[model samples]
Target: MSEVLGHHANEILIVSIVAVVAVGLIGLPGLFALTVPIALFGVVLLSWVAMRQHDRRLCEQCLLSMPLNPSERAVRLKRRFWMAHTGSEPRFLIPYVVVLLASNFATTTTIGRIGWAVMQLSMVYLIMSQSTHRKLQPWCPWCSEGGGGAEVDETDPVLPQDDRQLI
Candidate 1:
């Protein structure tokens, strides 16, 4: 559980830091406030569209490094991005939405806002990490492979198997 929490914390912290720096550098009038929210919304919409297709192939580094035809490549790339963005499931998005909504009603003061941010971030991280760990971790090449995962396997038998053959 600590491992899961730690990973989410690191991810959120890095993203927060980068966003803060970006906003600082660009300033409010530069459309940082406007474009980021739109982009984020677009990403969520695209992720939902991709998830509707329901492809369950592991999209970790190992699969990505394999050579694919143009059409197959496009599909795999969509699946890969969807998995990374949405944990390959719609249910996983619930906690985040709840957190964002709840945060608004929970805090008004500066200290309250700070405390709420910490509490909510921690809560969401714990929930997401535990709930999605098993499903999402397998799609991570290293975690699924006991930490010695290969980045790519050129000799993998699936490489020579044509997708049309299965169709």
Candidate 2:
């Protein structure tokens, strides 16, 4: 999992640098109209590839468990965003922050601004979706290797032995 995270970190870093450079050289007018679709498609393709590489299966139960109400969904998204930035794997926050700062510094037109906003939202959605997926993977039927259901023991202690005893 760490290896997969590292690979994604490198990919995101490269994309972040290219995005900043491209935005800095906004000499071509109306370029966002042409690039936005391609960029969005690339984001989806890369996300699919990363999921396949990580052997993640979208669990039906997990998908259904997510809140359907817009307000609840927004709250959950906000929570996940905070978790991504503050959790143990906070390294992902670096590229996200870089892109955000670059967008503010370099976006000059309304179209460019909208495109950047969409891209940022999409990236965050994908990242948070994967985080949620991985967190529930231990119980995902399809992600269980060579089994129809999860093989992991649900009663296994997540805390240290001493802490488990205290609990």
- The lDDT of each candidate is 0.45, 0.51
Distance from true location, Cα of 72 in model 1, Å: 35
Q: Tell me the tens digit of each residue's lDDT in model 1 across 47-157.
A: 334432222334343244444454454344444433444543458667756765676566566665655566444533443443233333335433444553332223433
Using all chains and alpha carbons, the TM-scores for the candidates as numbered come to 0.33, 0.29
Task: Give the clash count for model 1.
Answer: 0
Off by over 4 Å in 1: 1-31, 44-55, 60-100, 123-132, 135-167
Residue 5, candidate 2: C-alpha displacement in angstroms:
8.0
Q: Model 2: per-residue lDDT, tens digit, 37-103?
A: 4674576566456645443433444455555564544444555534433432447667757776677
Q: By summed lDDT, which 10 consecutive residues of candidate 2 come out lowest?
A: 81-90
